[model samples]
Target chain A: MNPEESLKFSYYPGCSVATTAAESNHSLMQVCRLLGLDLQELEDWNCCGSSSAYSVDPELGFNLSARNLSLAPGDRPLLVMCPRCLHHLRHTHLEMQQDPRKRRAQERRWGRPISPDLEIVHFLEALIRFGLDRLKKGAARNLNGLKFVPYYGCTLFRPPALRRQKYYQAEVENILTALGGVAVTRTYNQRCCGSFLSAVKPELVTSLVNDIIGSAVAAGADCLVTTCAMCQLNLEVRCTAAKRLPIFHFSEILALALGAKDCQGWFIRHLVNPRPLLKDRGLLGPPRLGQVP
Target chain B: MNSQPMPAKTTEVINISELDHHFATEVDRRSQADLKRCYQCRTCGNGCPFVEAMDYPPYGVIRLVQFGMRQKALECATIWVCVSCHTCSSQCPNSIDIAAIMDTLRSMALEERAVIGNKEILAFHLEVLHSIERYGRTHKLGIMLRHKLLTGQWFKDVDVGLRMLTKRKLDLVASKVRAMDEINRLFLPYWRVKPR
Candidate 1:
């Protein structure tokens, strides 16, 4: 995937990626260059309405996500990283594919014809598809002995019946394997993180934070890695409110193995410092380690 | 000991007729797509962690709205309590988006200055957004201070302060984003007009 060549993906970096998780976006670009995967940022991409719109009006939610799905080029698979976005788009795609009446209702609501040909694939699957073994070969450094809990948090491989059949269910351990890291087995891997509760009712978020991080800590995980930005924000923010746990977007960890910098260059600033744990693990790379007075 | 007999006023306490006009108007203004389908199975109710602490349960809140009990529904603790987790929506057999409706309800209540209950929580919510408006992202300290100042609870949560201090969590020093001016400029209107 040459940065200059035409190896492109129809990328949908959701709202959070653009602003809050800028480092993940930057690292994604860096890894894309390293892997020679060209990403064409979809023009005029709108909010997938996240979980909000979907809850407001199911038809409206489907149409909004489908409208974005409809924007992808006919040839390329639509690439999305956020699991919430993936779940919503996948739900819409599956629903539209399975039912003509639902599709017609959505199309009528959207006031435009919708495309049925688009296939949505998450960035994790894309990386796996591109070959994790090859990715390991490209790693500038190994994540040796860095134990992490691969927190999937429900959305990625949820409602197992609907998700399993779609081949959406995956153990992130193999990707962890690619980085030469051990994925600690933790039951919180699929637990609910009390997602949107952080904004509306943070006290409940406190209990969820306790459980999620407590599970990872109990599992002896040195860190937490996830695919969704909302999950990342909730875990990181609530972790601050509760305890200090290092939670990273999966790509940030991947970027670390690629040796971009220790902790993805000040993105750690947004998080409560996880340096103490990283120090305990002796995994602190140059930049993060350098910041120690 | 014998329990005191209830006063006649207690039985006459259903002054809910006053709420009908407002409830009817609001329902007319908002979409009622699946509002009537709720059977109070409380699937959404059980999914909501906030329901236990709510003055009205999630299903009861919907029932209130459906019955045009606007004042009681708006005044219900569930409106302030819902965290917008979508667990309820996900579990809903009718696929009714109870959580988003909660958001719409909160916004409506704030717009109408109808926050008779959970004013502190509502103020905290607004203060959180105001902090974001000023800093582009939350600086926990700023939000806490602003919420405290607004709610007149500056010294009330001393135990919280002590814990944060012991944890080395409170940065007495200010932390800010570079675009503070632009961000604050963008959000000033919202803060100014937002319900106190």
Candidate 2:
């Protein structure tokens, strides 16, 4: 009962999150609520514009995105689960901070001063910061014999944009370990999944998705867990051929470890059914086939 | 009627209206500084793994855009061909954000009904976006079925599907709608407005 000891954060579920990774936001909301973490959603936020804007017009892209950064309600740090949003926000912050003139011009465009008061941290980092011991004790199901591939994609470390970092892979591994799952670190973990290719050249995406999936599958990982919605969608949906291998969002796993049954309630609708792996790991009780209940 | 060949001097007069200001606005909005920096070194094309199959290599399109030849640039398959790996941005000596700009162009092209070549790919993107709007996260089989149905390419990829099926790859079910109401409330507004 020391409720005061439980940490709370402001949640930012980006565009992809509200649409494509709804399960992640849902699961995160439920699991965090149960864990006594308070997450208040910001009001009237726009798309981070992601990597898309950087290539078109850097200033306008950053200005539009900076307006979003300016709109976050109050001084608390923003908790982001999407890696794309993380990259956008962090990159925007770094660029704005590095150049005073650019920052001032961006401020003029946004009609407001964009202060770096809010520190953006990924959910995986939050799990570690909250301490793995607590997460381990909270697990209702010990994920025994469950092997997973941690798909980092390209966002975790890129553009040499941010410093003050710990070992990214180790951080993710530590969190997974606390949840009773094993992480299989592989070369392709940090590689590109040709995420934007899903739009224009899917044949290329299909082939690239195959390679990323092949690497994970070959590494003997039963599924791929990631913090990026784009990576999750690309790996799970683009591989029309290998759709059986589930790609669980990190929020889903955290929800599971927190003993929230709602994850299973929503799990039924997952593109790639996770029952086979969950059953083998004893994560789900009994065999419930083709049933959301 | 016998057609008169245009004089060389007249050919030099560029029609600026054909430049696609909408696309230019989008590109300028996204890659303002970087777009002018591209110099057609073919580094972007050379680095792109899919360039060999593309109708217009990426670098050439940048050159076309720089020269303000709108129709020719927009008509090419370069935007559709880019994989958005950032290899070009990483390798470019001038710091051009080529891949991201390409994404913006595709988004604009999608909006203007200007899309050409790779109809199947366009269908897939729309399918995935639609699925997310409907269920708030794509269901693999649903996306595949929609993409295949819309493109009439279902049977074409059946071999890939079969191999995956034999290997226990494809799943036959959809994801659970645990908090369907919340998902609906959040997603409905965007679809109502339609993407621009």
TM-score of each: 0.62, 0.64
The true-versus-predicted C-alpha distance at residue A126 of model 1, in Å, is 0.6
Best by TM-score: 2
Q: Tens-digit lDDT track for model 1 on A197-287? A: 5644566676777777887887887788887777776787666334457877788777766666646364544455666765666556553
**CA-only RMSD, every prediction:** 9.3, 10.2
User: Per-candidate DockQ versus the true complex?
Assistant: 0.07, 0.09
Model 1 regions lying over 4 Å from their true place = A1-8, A54-63, A94-114, A159-167, A240-243, A261-268, A275-293, B1-49, B53-196
Give the lowest summed-lDDT range of ten residues in model 1 chain A.
A284-293
Interface RMSD of each: 8.2, 8.0
- Model 2: iRMSD? 8.0
Q: What C-alpha lDDT values do all the predictions have?
A: 0.64, 0.64
Q: Write the per-residue lDDT of candidate 2 for residues B14-106, one digit (tens) a residue.
A: 676666455455566755436766766766666565665566667776766676666666657767656565656666777777766676666
